[model samples]
Target: MKFVKDGASDIGMKLHPFTLRFVDDQAYLEEEYRSYYFSESISSIRITLVLAIFFYAVFAGLDVAVAKQYQTQLWLIRFAFVIPVLVLLLILSYRPWFRKNVQALVGIGMYLTGFGIILMIFYISKIGLYTYYAGLMLIFLIGYTFIRLRIVSATIAGWSIVLTYEIVALCFAHTPTIALINNNFFFVSANVIGMLICYFLDRTNRRDFFMRKLLEVERNKVKAANDVLEQKVQERTQQLLETNVELKKEIELRKQYEQERTKLEAQLMQLQKMETIGTLAGGIAHDFNNILTPILGYTEMALEEVEEDNTLRFDIEQINHAAVRAKDLVQ
Candidate 1:
């Protein structure tokens, strides 16, 4: 349905004046209203049709009292024409096409119903049944309230009933002027009142339909916003999880690097101790070689001077051997 652009403060809706129907541009909304209105009012319409049929049949008793000579003929008109049509309309109310063109079809049913009464009045008024015109008011009431006819159908059916009554009463019946004027007053009053009720009731129904649709649109919008928010929350949660995993990997790498640095420091300290021990050992060996060199030279000079057969010569030979042994140890 199109919204009216008249700078209204609320949701905009516009309806035609005569019929109180949605504008032509709102065909889809009008169709939706037809379905909704039918569902809402169909049961009541059926009950009203049954009541109408019952009253029409019971009025056969009135035929007996009012016009005894033509009671049988009147019964024929009631049973044969009007009651059956009401029954047919009741049956068709469950059919599919009734929903599509509900107002037009209702107008037809109401026409047949009121026209049948006009025929009865046409005949009976000749015998001074001047009060019979009051029955047509019942048609307006039933069509408006019970049958739940929309303003368009009710107006057309009501005005047409009035027109038909006028033609018959004026042209053929030759009724008195006073009776015609009296009937016209009541007829016009009922139609006007019925039309007003029908028009307001329709306006209320259309307002309800628009509100329900607007509520649905609002609900869908909220759901869409919630979905987007949920998606963003999920994405941020995923990013945090990824960052946590990366930090754990970096921490593990730092631990491994600290262990490697400790191992390298221990190896360097051990290498420094080994080099200090080697330098101390080289210095001690050089000092012992210097002392041994002097002892070896003195022992050799004593061995050369000594004899082979004397005790002193034997002592000198032993000292030379000890000195030679000490020199080999130093080397």
Candidate 2:
């Protein structure tokens, strides 16, 4: 549908006014339509031609039923001209050229088939002309609606047949004025009605094509948006994963820092306790040094008095040794 805006002008035109073609600048879109119309109508075109062949061949029996002046001209018109042309059209359906020009070829085939009926009317006697006129009406119906010719092509083919019939009736065939008027009336009516049918059919088909193109565009946009969303999700997921990993590392580092803080706090507490004990020991040692001074002086005096190889001197010397060791500890 991106093409809908730039590729077509009357993206809004529901029914193409005259040409039944897109704007002149929209050639690419027109070509796309042509391809779509061709492929879609080809099978029907072939089937319609086959039906034409069958029916046209069957109508050869009319020559036997309504012979005028022993005329075999109708038989030649059916077998030699019209049936062969319809068969050629059937064969052309399989050709590459036909894909691009299907409507034109089908229109041409339709016109020639109607013209063959006109020839029949010319060759048939006045007593049996009404039957062939009805055949012409049938051709109009098939060409306009069933053969899938657009309104323009169907109109051209249909009115051209009418014009040819008028000329043949007036100049060559000697048709009475009343009969020609009657035939013209029916022919004109059929052409007008067929035009309407072709118009509606064409309009409807084009609308459907436009809707399908829009649907494709919407689907593409949705897919693109979904792709973007998916990419964003993946990116966000990766970011969260990285953030989680960093968060885990931060948590581990914080725990280690806390543990180190606790260990330092315990070591500081132990050092403070040891320092308090040392302070207490220093005060006690200072007091004890003062108390041991007199004891050391008296023990030395007693040792001096108990000298001269006496057992009393030995005991006094031991007491002096103990008092001196105590004094050194206090110092």
RMSD to the true structure for each prediction, in A, is 6.6, 5.3
Q: Give the per-residue lDDT digits (tens) of candidate 1, residues 1-331.
A: 3332244434566578776666754544676777888899888888888999899999889989898877877787899999999899889988988777767877888888899888888779878887678779889888876788888788889999999999999998877899999999999999999988888887888888878766766776788798999899999999998998998999998988988888888888887877787677667768877876777677677667766676787776777688678667656
TM-score of every model versus the real structure = 0.71, 0.72
Candidate 1 clash figure, as a count: 0
Per-residue lDDT of 233-262 in model 2, one digit per residue for the tens? 999999999999999999999999999999
Overall lDDT per candidate, in order of appearance: 0.81, 0.83
Worst 10 residues of 2 by lDDT: 7-16
Count backbone overlaps in model 2: 0
**Alpha-carbon lDDT of model 2:** 0.83
Q: Using TM-score as the measure, which candidate wins?
A: 2
Off by over 4 Å in 1: 1-10, 24-28, 241-331
